[model samples]
Target: MAPTLLSSPLQGFTDFRFRNAFQHYFGGIDTFYAPYIRLNGQLKIKQSYQNDLQLENNSTLNVIPQVMTNDPDEFLFVVKYVQSLGYKELNWNLGCPYPMVTKSGMGSGLICNPTRINEVLHKAHNESDIVVSMKMRMGYENATEILDAFPILDKYPLKNIAIHARIGKQLYNGPVDLDAFEKCISGTKHKLYYNGDITSLESFKKIQNRFPTIDHFMIGRGLIADPFLPNMIKNDTKAYPKNRWEIFSEFHDRIYQQYDEYLSGPTPIKMKMLGFWEFFSQSFPNPQKIVKAIKKASSPKKYQETVASILKNV
Candidate 1:
C-alpha cells in the first residue's frame, strides 16, 4: 500500500554526509532532502556550506538542496545559486515550527502571515528561473492559518509539495494530527506529499488505507531506526535472522568506519554511535547489554571493541 520512500530532513542528522552513507548500503530512499541552508545577509555562499552540496560528488544521487529565509530576494539568490549546480527544483521551508525560526518570520511561523508568504512566493517565482516547491507543516500557531495560505499557494505551479502532518508548536512531540492533515489536503489544490512519524511498514499501510492518492512518503526516524527499511518495504521482506546480521553489519560498519576516519577526538565517535543506538537498539539481539557496553565505552579503542562486540551479538 505504501508509495515510494523519501528521506525527510532531520536538521543535525540528515546532512549530505549522513544521506550519502545511508544510501550507499541501504537503498530504500528514492530521494533525500538535504538539511536546510540557513542564509545570513551575505550574497556569497560559504565555503563550508558549498562543500556540503557540491554536485561533482557522486553520492549526491537524488539530493535536493533546501534554503531557509523569509526574504524574497534571498530566495531568488539561492535559486540562482542552486541552478548553477544543475538542480532542476528548489524546495522552500514554510513548515518549520520552532520558536527561533517563527520569531524571525520564517519556517512554520510564516503560516500565520499568508499575505507575506504570498508576496514572497509571487516575487520569487517572477525572479526565479527554476522549478520551485515547498515543504510546510499544517500551520505554526493554528491549523486555520493554512486556509489563508492555501489560496496563495494554489496560484503557484509548483513541482510538488511535502507537508509534515502537524502544526509548528507540536514539533514532533505527540502523534501526528491526521485530521488536520486531511483538512489541509482538501483545502489545497497542489500535488501533496506526506511527511511524519512513519516509523515502520505497519504505519505506512495505515497511511495508504487512509489516503489512497499518495504516491510519495517522506520518512525520517523510521529509516534511521532501521537502515534496511526501504529495502524491506520494496521487497515486502520480513525479518530473517539469516540475512539480518549481514545487512545490519554492512550498514553499521560502513558508517562507523567513515565517522571514525573523519571525526577526531573521543566523544565524536561515541556520540555518533550513541545517536545511532536510538534506532539501532531495535535490531540488537540483546538490546540492554549491547547498549550498556556502548554507553560505558570511554576511549576510541574501547569504543571500537564495544561496537564490534555489539555487532557480533546482532
Candidate 2:
C-alpha cells in the first residue's frame, strides 16, 4: 500500500532547504507544497518571495507552488509565473488565519464571500492551463462557514481539497472536528485530503482506521518536533531514542551545515534554530530550561554547546 505521505507546508518551518534535508535521510513524503506566496495585487514577486520560489533552490525537491490572493488577476499572475518555473500544479490558500491577512480581504476572511471564490476559481480555470488545487479551513470565523461555500467549491475543477477542519479563529487550537470533516465528505464531490493535528503515531492510527481509504495527509509542527514522524508513519514503527543525544546531534549538524552554506551569517543561523525550537522543544528533555538557554545563547558556538549540554544531560 503506497500511503501518499505529504509534507505539510508551515510558513516558518517547512521550506525547500528543510524539505530537501529531510528527504535526504528520511524519504517518505511524496509531494511538498511551498509556503503560500502573497501576490500583493501588483503582479510582482518580492525578492525574498522570489528566493523562496526559485527552481534552482529546490531541484532536489518536488514542490507545488501556492499563492494566497483574492484578486483574480493577482492569482492568475502568480500561477502563470509558477508555470513558467515548470510547475504543473498551483494551490490556492484560503486557509491562512492571520488577522492582518483576513482584515485585508484575503485568507479565511475570503471565505465570508463565496461569490469571490467562485469568481477567482472561474478565472483561474479559464485562464491558466495548469492544474489548480485548494487548501482551506472549515470556515472563516465559524465551523458552518464552509457550508455556504461548498457548492461553489464543488463547481470548480479542483485537483484536491485539503481541509484543516476548523474555523479561521480557531488558529491551531482545540481538536480538529472530525464531524466537520465528515461534513466535507458529505458536502463536496471534490477528492478530500486531511490536514490538522496529526502529530503522534497513535493519533495517526485513529485517522487511518477512520478513513482507511485516505491517501494524503499533511503534517507540520509534528514533523519538526519529530523529524522521524513521516518515517514512523510509513513503516508504522515507533522511534525509540536510546542514543537520543546522538540522534539529536546528527540531525542538528546536518540541518546546520546546510543552513550555514546557504545562509549568510550568525544572525540568520540563529533565527532558523530559534524558530525550530518552538516545535523541537516538544520532544526534548527538560524542554523549558533548554529552550531558555537556547534563546539566551549569544553566539553560534554558545548555541551549539547549549544543544550539546542538553542532550548529554538526557
Candidate 3:
C-alpha cells in the first residue's frame, strides 16, 4: 500500500501562506496539520491563529487544527473554536520539545504527568463530540515516560497518536529511536503514525519497512527544505523534474510576495524568509554559504538578488 504523507506542524514556519503555496506548487501531502494554536493562559484565540483556520483560507486542502495546552478549559475552548471553523478533528500537541514550552508544563513536559493528561483529555471527551488526536514525543526526559502514559491515553477515543520517536530532551538532535517506536505500535490500541528524521526518500522507505503497519507519516522541516520530496517519495523516484528550480523559484516568489505584503517592514520579511532558508539551504551544495548570503541581504532587493544568485548556480 502507498504511504499517507502528512505535513507536520512547525510553529512559526507552516502557517497558511506556506501551506497554500506548497499545495499549489508541490502536491503530495495527503493532509496538512496546522501549527498548534497556543493559548498561553488566555481563553481567547489569537487573530493569527484565527486566520490560519478560517474555512475559506483552507478550502483547497485537508487541514487538521491543532492546539498546545495543558489546561482542559483551553483544550475545550480550542476545540469549540476549530469546530466552529468547520474542522471536525483537533490534534493536541504534546510533541513540541522547546524549552520555554516544556518548562511551562505544556508540550512534552506534560507527558510525564499522566494524571494531568487524563484531566485534560477527560474534560475534552466529556464536553465535546469533536474528534481528538495527539501529536507527542515519546517522553520528556526518557522514552519510558510515554509507556506510563499510554494507559491513560488508551481510555479516550483518540483519532490517532502521532509520535516523534525521540524523547523531549533530545529535541531534534539525535537519531529517532526506531526500537522504541516499534514498541509504541503495541503500547496502545490507537493507530500510530510515525514522525521524525524522515528527510528523504530513503529514510521514508527505511521507516516504512520497519513499521509496515503504520501508513501515516509526518514530514516537518524536511518538507520546507525539499518541497518536491513528498511527491517524489509518493512516486518513488529519485529524479527531479526538468524544471525543478523553476517551480521552486516560482513558489518562492509567490510566498515572498504574500509575506512581503502582509508584513509591515523589510526586516520582518527578511527574518521570516531567513527562518525558512535555515532549512532551504540544506538543499544546496554549500548550506553555510547560502545561509550566509541570505543573512547578509539587508534589503528586500538584496534578498531577492541573493535568492536569484543562489538559484542561478543550481
Candidate 4:
C-alpha cells in the first residue's frame, strides 16, 4: 500500500500562503498541520494564527489545527477557538525543542511531567467535544522519558501520537533513534506516526522498511528543502520532471508576491525569503553559493534579479 505523507508545521515558514502554493504546484501531502497557535498568558489567539486557520483560507486543503500550551485553561481555550473555526481535530504540540519554550514548562518540557500532560488532556477531553492528537519528541533530556509518559497518554483517546524520534535537547541535530522509535511502537495503545529526517526517498524507504506498521510520515524541514519530495515519494520516482526548475520558479514567485503584498517593507520580505532559502538552498547544486547570492541581494529589485539569476543557472 502507498504510505500517507503529511506536511509537518514549521512556525515561521508553513503558513496558509505557502501551504496553498505548495499544494497547487507539488501535490503529495495527504494533509498539512498548521503551525501551533500559541496564546500568551491571555486566552486570545493571534491574528496571524487566526488567518492561517480560517476555513476560507484553507478550503482547498485538509488542515489540522495545532496548539502549544501546558496549561489546562489555555488548552481548553484553543480547543473552543478551533472548534469555532470548524476544525474537528486539534493537535497538541509537545515536541518543540527551543530553549524559550522548554524553559517555560511547555512543548518538550511538558513531556517529562505526565501529570501536567494528563491535566491538560483531562480538561480538553472533558470540556470540549473536539478530537485531540499529539505531536511530541521522545523526551526533553532522554529518550526513555516518553516511555514513562506513554502509560498516562494511554489513558486518553488521542487520535495518534506523532513522535519526532529525537529528544528535545538534540534540537534537529544527530541521527534519529530508530531503536528508540521501535520501542515506542509497543509503548502506547494509540497509533504512532513517524516524524524525523525523512529528507529523501531513500531515507523514507529505510524507515518504512524498518517499521512496516507505521503508515503516516510527517515531513518538516525536508518539505521546504525540496518541495517536489513528497510528490516524488508518492510516485516512487527519483527522477525530476523535465521542467523541475520552471515549476519551482513559479511556486517561488507565487509565494514571493503574496508575502510581498502582505509584508510592508522590503526588509521583512527579504528576511522572510532568506529564512526559506536556508532550507531551499539545499536542493541546489551548491547550497552555500546559492545562499550567498540570496544574502547579497539587498533590495527587492535586487532580490528578484538574484532569484532569476539563480534559477537561470538551472
- Give TM per candidate: 0.92, 0.94, 0.99, 0.99
By TM-score, the better pick of 2 and 3 is 3
Weakest 10 consecutive residues of candidate 4 by summed lDDT: 121-130
Clashing pairs in 1: 95-137, 96-108
Candidate 2 residue-wise lDDT, 136-213, digit = tens? 898877888888888999887789988887789877788899887877777888888888888888888888788875
Lowest summed lDDT over 10 consecutive residues: which window, candidate 2? 239-248
The residue pairs in collision within model 4 are: none
- lDDT per model, in order? 0.80, 0.82, 0.93, 0.95
User: What does candidate 1's lDDT look like per residue over 45-76, in tens digits?
Assistant: 77656866788653547988888888888888
Please give the RMSD to the true structure for each candidate, in Å.
2.2, 1.8, 0.8, 0.7
Off-target runs (Cα >4 Å) in candidate 4 are none
- lDDT tens per residue, model 3, 41-152: 7799999999988988898999999999999998999999898888899999998899999999999999999999999999999999999999999999999899999999
- Going through the candidates in the order shown, the clash numbers are 2, 0, 0, 0
Among residues 3 or more apart in sequence or in different chains, the pairs in candidate 2 whose N, CA or C atoms overlap within 3 Å are: none
For candidate 3, the lDDT comes to 0.93
**CA-RMSD of model 3:** 0.8
Q: Alpha-carbon error at 286 in model 1, in Å?
A: 6.7
